[model samples]
Target chain A: MHGMINKSIEDLVTIQFGADKWEAVKKKAGVTETAFVSNQSYPDAMTYGLVGAATEVLGLTADQVLYAFGEFWVTHTAFKGYGDMLMSAGRTIGEFLDYLPLFHTRVALIFPNLKPPRFECSDRHENGITLHYFSDRPGLSMVVVGMLNGISKLYKTPAVVTHTKFKDKGADHDEFLVNWGAADQK
Target chain B: MTDSAPMLDHGQFSKLFPFHFIVDADMRVIDTGSVLARVCPKIVPGALINDHFLLFRLASEPIKAFNRDFIARQENTLFVFKSTSTDLMLRCQVLILRDPERYLFLGSPWVRNPTELKALHLVLQDFALHDSTVDLLQLVQATSTSLHDAKQLSEKLEQRVADRTAELSMANAELSRVMRSKDDFLSAMSHELRTPLNAILGLSESLAEGVYGDMNTKQVKSINTIAESGHHLLALINDLLDIAKIGAGKMELELTKANVEDLCQASLRFVMEQAQKQKINLKLVMDNQSVMLTADERRLKQILVNLLSNAVKFTPNGGSVTLETKCDLESESLMFSVRDTGIGIATEDLKRLFSPFTQLDSKLSRQYAGTGLGLTLVMKLVELHGGSVAVESEIGKGSCFTVRIPCKGLDTLNQHNPSGTISLTEITPAETLPSNTPLILVADDNEINLMTVTDYLRANKLRVIQARDGLEAVKMVREHIPSLVLMDIQMPLMDGLDAIAHLRADDKHTDMPIIALTSRAMVGDRERCIAVGANDYLSKPVNMKQLVKTIRAHLPNDETL
Candidate 1:
């Protein structure tokens, strides 16, 4: 996993919970890192440990923690450099989802060690789309749902997302069905 | 290659280079890319390119011409031009197309700062994906963000440290204020208590001496008890004050060369009566009887006396108490141990023995009445001399308390004297008086004090005069030309300190001895009295014998009676 992802989770915990709680979470996770540099890679197990500790320390489920982190990623100013990158994805949520793979490829150029997950658009409709999320890391379907909602908020389209398939329950990969109001209504 | 081999159409070219423009040999714009046309509306078909734009740089230098020869010479190198209307610098790669012999300028606007991108009405998307300019913009923004965050964090940390320092400073100031108030209270309390006490003890001493008249045996015994109890109370108050002074860091040592044997004899004499009353045997053990020590004479005597007194008090009748002294020349330290073969102290009681007001057993404290401050004072006085005290005791055998004092500097000449005992020198009073009475002036504000002191002096065959205040005292000195003046401090209408200063200013009275007497026994009282020209200082509840002795010591032989 990239440190940018871990840094985003740290920001989420510190901003919402408080810096002391973030320290406890770090200690509970047995992670000695004081500061995480963006565009750097970290052990995937370290990141998973943080999430696991966050669940026990924050008194929240893993899905809830990841969902909050995903929502915070798009809205946080700590990653303002990625604002232009997100803006260059597309004008609306549907266009953005269609261009997600190419966007990740460009992001991989910026973070040379990034192992970006594959995003595919399938079963498209006028007001919705079936999003295929493929990654070696599991148990992050809720993050995708949160990100879709966050994108709808960005585009002012008012979205609702449901996890249609699961990888943790022995499916080949995860999937989310994203639906939104007409763009003109906003 | 054929010109028609699936070449990019106008739309494709416009999308590829949105800021592109083409100019014919006549220097008129033939066509402009759609985006460039919107930015510079005058650069359209058949418009003059030179009128709308300036050739700002050629080979990194300013070029004023956009003619054919100027364009032909700059072929492969980069060129920079600016739109006159927008003041935007455009980096261009020029291509010469043969079909129409036109020069096509293909480029985008150049920007250095991220803020410039916004001011130029450009976004990151305007630059082609292959260009590194957009990445440069991102890096600049990231650097700015990191610097801003670092500055904020530094400021926050500095603020926290400043706050903590301020809190600590406030606490320290408050503690100092409390300590000052406590010292003032102690000084005032001591002064107030001693004023009446001086009269009590002085009159009792006079009564016991039969100054009034001869008394019966019963009266003599009762008077002795009164004197004894008064002395005991004075001791308790002095001990309390000493403890307070030590705790306040105001106690100081007056170091002097003192004969160890003399010191031991003086200390033993203090507790000899008590040991005799209990029938406890007293013994002295030392390697050499003439060994001398460099120490504060008074305080060393006080330390040894306290240990011996405690030893005598705790030991049963017929038990032996011993004073042992050893000098270690190698370590330059002197050790004195007081061991008692009495009912021994329990092991558990030894730890709390030196804590003030702590008695091992309430029953024992009642049985053995004491202030319970002796050991504590001993420990503090020893520490002031850069020394330590240790004790060894058993449940049924006895207890031994040893004090070790380090003395790095001592005069070898005084270290040993062949004489077995050194006699203390004292001032001898005049055996005969002059025909005229010698006048002594006593100044005090309190009536009892004035009467008691004058009565005591008169009984010693001296003519006494009285002054109620410093003003009257000074007047009496000039009027009577008294041989000696006893000045009381803290009087109304000019204090003793001022009175002494006033009298010393006169050449006629400069030779007259003035003794400053005060009820306050504070740390700097004596020094302050002497600083203002007082010949001597005495703390009250004055001992009449010491007072007369001090007067005799300071009086001239011609005047003393």
Candidate 2:
């Protein structure tokens, strides 16, 4: 994890809720630094702790908080400087999701120590797809839910999501079912 | 989950598993659960798992030998299946019970959606409503669409930036072209104006010196005035060319050791008469015996002369102008200061004093008449020497202009001339030795330039043959085979450069001295003339002394004797 990730999370909390919420979240996370450096790398424990603390401070379920943060990462983080990179990778939400494995590899250029997840997309159809999610760490599959919602918003393509299998429920990997509708006209 | 596989399972199991079966050690389906019996009523207990069902991951193998959780080196890995009677495929989880030595398989139908299960020859009420695969499918679809939009936006922005950059560079190129045109215009004007001035000044000299006829006192003085006025205009024109050369970084210098004292005293002589007329007291102050540096003597003299003349022009009647020199041993610098006690410049004007073409009192009726380029030339010249000039003045008290240049002596910083072989100083209008002088052929298109040079050479008692064009000159040179040929570069028929090339190529006149005369003083013109086979080269408005000396230097010694 990097301080930029923490800063982005802080920014999301502050902007979506309020400055007071961010202050409480930061306090609960036990972060001593008032401000995180944008480029400095920090321990992975710090980022995971912050996410957990954010859920507690905001009085939201862990799924809701992680899912909201995942959506925020796309709308905000990708826009920071990686919009061109993301754009070059994919033109549609389906294609972009299919390219997630490659995207993480490219993201590793910027974050050298990133422990990125592996994504495998299969059984693609006109309306929906089966997405295979693999990661070394476990128990935050709900964040993928939020990320899917954010991506649909980015593309103006509304979609419904269902968890096919849960890593928490002793499945080998988390799998998701995605069904898409026509893109929004606007 | 994978790191803790292969515990011989018996206590923990799902009793309500769909399509449960037990396979004995001999690959035989010994017993079947009630649900399996309900699903397949005619199927007996002897039906093998592989014979009855086809696994999508792997078909159930004949259970011959089981070792290390892999029966016959193959594992189901939760194989998916479809019943022989129904179109539904079940996701089967297998448990090999090693203690009882039985195989238990639990099967549940794979459902991508609740609606998808209705067409699979099964009732909608037969299975549960909850399925997570549908949500996972939606996540992948949305991510791809967003990236495509971003790609489109980025490409558009990149194209816009490229277009803007191209426009800026094209505009920059046009501006550079305009600047070059302006520079060329100034250079051409300098050369064009000076060519005619050379004839005017030279003709005036011949008249004043009684070359054509005798002159009375008033006529002589009038001619003198005209000549002096012509020289002043010529100096201003030369300054235009010199500054242009400096700006283009084409100015070259010839270095020799020059005495600072001698340079100052000699420069003082040029302004002595003017100072006397103004009743200004001129003085020289020296700090030591020797003040010397490696420099171009004539250019250094020109600098000293410009400073002395400025000092004299500004000083009032009975005011003093002093030239001071100091050899600073501590810094190894030669410092020259020109101090004047006339009307010192205001503090505000001092900042812009050396700017080109700027006269503080710009009115026509100002006390000093000048082009206001003298100080600019001085500043540029000092900079060329790797030095600096500064001024200190108080209004109406006095002004001291100081020049400090490093004392490099004679060891370094000698400049090489990119022009022809001969030096300007070495050419001093050869003292007319009288031994039937050399037979010289002069070629030029300008009648006035031709008349001026011919008369000057005739006065020195040299036998001269004239040609109006390069063709005529070439014919004359071949016919007369004169001791020397003075060729003008730009001519009406076959230019001087071409004629020189022709003359040098022939076997007859291979060693003949051909001196190039050009009115255009642009850089590389001299080099072009010499490269084309002229023995030496000269620039127009011809300095009569220099022209005569160049001719004499290249002429054979036998011709002079």
Candidate 3:
């Protein structure tokens, strides 16, 4: 991933996981990739790549577009991962989504553009499911689809996702929509 | 008629325009206008007009911005200014009458002298500043006076505190001096009473023991009565002094952890002989095994002994005196009771059981001999140990005296050793003194005491030297250098303390062991004797055995004897 994209991921993780949890997630993700990142260092290539993708999609400079993408990605990813983990442990996806507001309320209030992803779990099927949303800007679909794919593999579940076009609505500018269902059923 | 000269002061034109001009605004002298010259003396005809804009700049903006058109049309326009060389301030204003192009018209001058106004202003300013200075000066004077008053007040208070402290110290010193004198007096009195009593007791005991020879029945009885009466008197004296010492707070407790059971048994045994003589059945019923208590062991023993002896003394033939002890584990206290089946205390006399100098009744008084101090001392000692004593009695059922003392834990047991017994094996009577023995000095103020001791020594074939008083004793000690000096505590001219101090102060007699022969059997007398450099002390009417042993103990190379 480009450094800008990685930075967007990190910023998103920070928003989703709080400062403490962000460090843990960063360490865990770094360990998985065998690329050790310290909390103190400058942005890497993956961060730039993510930022570049976000800027192209949002029609903004890398700096302005990177900040929003970082926030949105971190918040949506954490909510989806948390809902999936809860649902896999025999929790109803509806109940998991209902509980999401308690932990993700700060992100929802701070980044109004970021939305909680829809969750789906099926008891009749062997595989669990999750779906996430991202903007349908130039390069975002590829990055978002790839992230959803990676998450699906990471959680050992199937993920379905979609997007919406970004609009200049001042504070309510960016938008997306996601739906998730059990892969076996779908 | 300067009409053709163009009437300079007034207009002769067809229309009268109100315009007036002076070439120079500085001087009152005017060129074309006559009225301007009369109104302002500084305006002059030919002097250049001073620009007013600089003066206008010094004026307040509001006044300087005032409408020139309004002033030109106004009836009166007057500008009053006060000026120094470097500064000018506008003071007042008046209205302008007409436009400047009009014919000249004049009004009376409204000018006030600037020097007078400035002087008055300066005087008013000085008065305001002086008023504050006067107020500050008054305040300073008031504060100084208050400070002086406070210093005087503090000095008086300090003097009062100093005076009170001095008075209190003086009173305390006098009280301490009086107490010392009282202790000295009591000690002297105890010695005086004991000396003669000792002589009587000693002589009687010797006679009863048949030391001189055997006696008939009547003689034996008479001697026995004498010895018994002497002993009783001595006991009474001792009791009264003990009560006095306790009341004076002179008695101190030597606390140790004692086994209450052992102390009670020993005390009971001590009174057993008396119980046997009285034919009273004495028994001990101690249920508590080895219960320990913190106390002065000797004093505790004394208390138990007194109670037991009192029980035995009051009990009639075949009556029983029972000693019982019970332990209260929760309270950690031991209760010792001496119940006697004898002439029981009357309900009315029960209150007097522990009262000093009180016996049961006159009837029992004749039958029993007591100083009545035994019970009082016992109660005092028991109270000292944080304990209490109570009595229960019926007229003929006997009296029971119970003492409750708080108990100490087992760790204190090691501190409670009974006083070591002084062995009498080494001492021999005066009659056993060998012939040709060294001369022994016997000092006693009482002639009877001196005679009795010397007679005993003479009978033993030992040479005797005598002294009438302590001073004489010291004199004799210096002259004779006797083998031993039997020094009396109380004597005329000088007492034992002075004589001993003097003797010990000297080199020759310092090592010569002086045996204190005193009748004062008070608790600290023996300590006092040794403190005054006496080798040992023997109570008056001293047991011949103890006296001889003490003498032998002090003698050099006399161990074989």
Candidate 4:
């Protein structure tokens, strides 16, 4: 995993909770690294260890932690570094989803060792699409759900998202059904 | 063209070079790419290209002319242009196309920073995926974050240091306050203890001198024992007070001219009786008998006496103790050594010899009956005179303690005494008095002190008058015109210094001799008494013989009862 992912998680925990809580989480996880470099690569076990520690320390389910982390990644981490790029990705939410498949391909040029997850959109329409997430790692379907909510918030269109399929339940990959328009403004 | 190859169409070409523009031979805009049209709206298909963009350089140098032929001549050269409409720049390579003679300006937007990218309303996606511009911008941002982290850590460490320094400063101030409090308590205790001791010594002396009545042999021996014990207690109290004063930096020297031979003889005589009691041979050897030193006379004598007493105390029966003095004229210094042949000190025990109240062996303390303060006092007093004391010894041989006092900066050659104190010889009433008795006035708040002094005065056949306080003493002096007055400094109504000042203010009693008496034998007490117009100062408990001599020395020649 890239350090950007762990950095985002650190910023999410530290900003929402306190720095001391992040320290407690790190202690529980037995993580000794104090600061993370953005483009550096870390072992996959570190990220998994952090999620497990956050679950015990913050008294939250792993799914809830991943969901919050995903939302934070879109709302804060990505926007802070690449706000203009985010805005230029699409003029509308459907176009942004259409660009998501090629988003990691463009970013991977800058981060040479990036092992990016794949995103695809099918059954696309004016207000919704079926967002398919494919990755070698398991148990991250909730993060995609949270990222859809973050995108909807960025476009100022309230959204309703449902996990349509899960790889844990013997599906091919994870799938989400997302809908957003003036009809779902609340 | 290859037979099996596919060619790039106009739409494919526009997508490939989205910021490219084509110009005619007349430098007019014939066509513009999609991104160039969107960024600079002024460039149209029919407008003049020179009106929308200015050629900054051709072939990496300043452009000579604004014609298409000049641009075509600069082959394999990079052209730089700044947009007049949006202030965006372009680094381009010109290609000559020969369908109707056109020049294609094929380039992307030239962005060096993130701010420039935003100013041009460009995003990372606007550049082709293979461009390295976005990577450079992200690297810059990461370095800035690292700098920010370092700055924050430095600020936190500085704040921690300031907090720790403040804590240490507060602790140091509290320690100073505690030390001052302890010194004040010791000073107060010294005065309180001496006041009672004064009465005890004064009344006992009067009894021993037969002032009350004649006594039997048994009663006389008991009185002598009580006097001896009282004197011993007085010496211990004085030593304790001296140690406290020196520790507090309140001990001041009263420098005067003193003869070296006289000082040595007095010290040797002081411990002569103890030496005889232990059957030890005491001797004095002086190299220069007439050498004089300008120093604090009392403290110098005390230093010598303390060393001589220690030498005598440590020597066994039938052992020898010697006091040897030498005056080194060239060095302008004096050296005094006290050597003893007894159970000599061990090499390691010599280091602890000058530490206060520490005997080398506890058993030696019991057998020798010593307070163990003699060498400590000797060292301190010698140091007060800017001198050093050294000792050399072996376990079976003798110990020699030598003290070196530097007299280089002192006024040793001038042999005159400048002290204004009256030298009171031991005088009886029959020798000093005339036909009429002298009138003496005694003022004291303590009844025991006043009674003891008055009895001694009357026993000497002097007419005595008593006042309870300084206020009454002042009134008594104005009324009775006594020959001399003895004023106790601490009194109920008024203190002796104030009474003396009040008398000195009056023209009639300006010459009245008022001696200040106090239990506070501290550094500034005598100076304070003299500064307030006291003729002389005496510390209690006063020796009766000495008191009578001081009174006789202060008595007016013609004044009588």
What stretches of model 2 exceed 4 Å from their correct place? A1-186, B1-68, B71-184, B200-232, B363-365, B409-546, B549-561
Residue-level lDDT tens digits of model 3 in B401-471: 99998875533432333332122222112222445475688888765466557655653445567777888
Q: Kindly report which residue stretches of model 1 are placed more than 4 angstroms away from their true locations once superposed.
A: A1-151, A157-163, A166-186, B1-81, B87-109, B112-115, B162-245, B248-265, B276-300, B311-374, B390-408, B411-561
User: What are the lDDT scores of the predictions, listed in order?
Assistant: 0.78, 0.69, 0.57, 0.77
When summed lDDT is taken over every stretch of 10 residues in candidate 2 chain B, the lowest stretch is B416-425
lDDT of 4 by residue, B1-561 (tens): 478787878777777788899989998888887778888988998888877777776355444347976887885887788887686998888998887899988888777656677778775556654455656665565555446545555776777788888999999899879878877887787778877776777666667656567999999899887866676676677787788778777889877556666566545656766878999887777665456777776677778777777778778889988888766666778888889996789998888999988999999877775566777878888888888999999887788999988887333563343322111121111212343678888898765466568656865768667787889999989988888889888787888888998999999988888888877655798899989888888887677889988888888766533
Global lDDT of model 4: 0.77
- Indicate the docking level reached by candidate 2: incorrect
Q: Where is the poorest 10-residue window by lDDT in model 4 chain A?
A: A177-186
Between prediction 3 and prediction 4, which has the larger TM-score?
4
In candidate 2, what are the lDDT values of residues A47-134, reduced to their tens digit? 8888899888888887788888878877776445344444434456777677676555444544466566778899887667788899
Worst 10 residues of 3 chain B by lDDT: B121-130
Q: Between which residue pairs do clashes occur in model 1?
A: none
List the candidate 4 regions with Cα displacement exceeding 4 Å. Answer: A1-186, B1-24, B30-37, B41-46, B54-82, B90-116, B200-273, B282-308, B322-338, B346-357, B368-393, B396-540, B543-561
Q: Please provide, for model 1 over B143-219, each residue's C-alpha lDDT reduced to its tens digit, 9 standing for 90 to 100.
A: 55556555555776788779888998998899899899989988998888777766778777667656567999999
Ordering by TM-score:
1, 4, 2, 3
Q: Best to worst by lDDT, what's the order? A: 1, 4, 2, 3
**Candidate 3 CAPRI level:** incorrect
Return the DockQ of model 2. Answer: 0.03
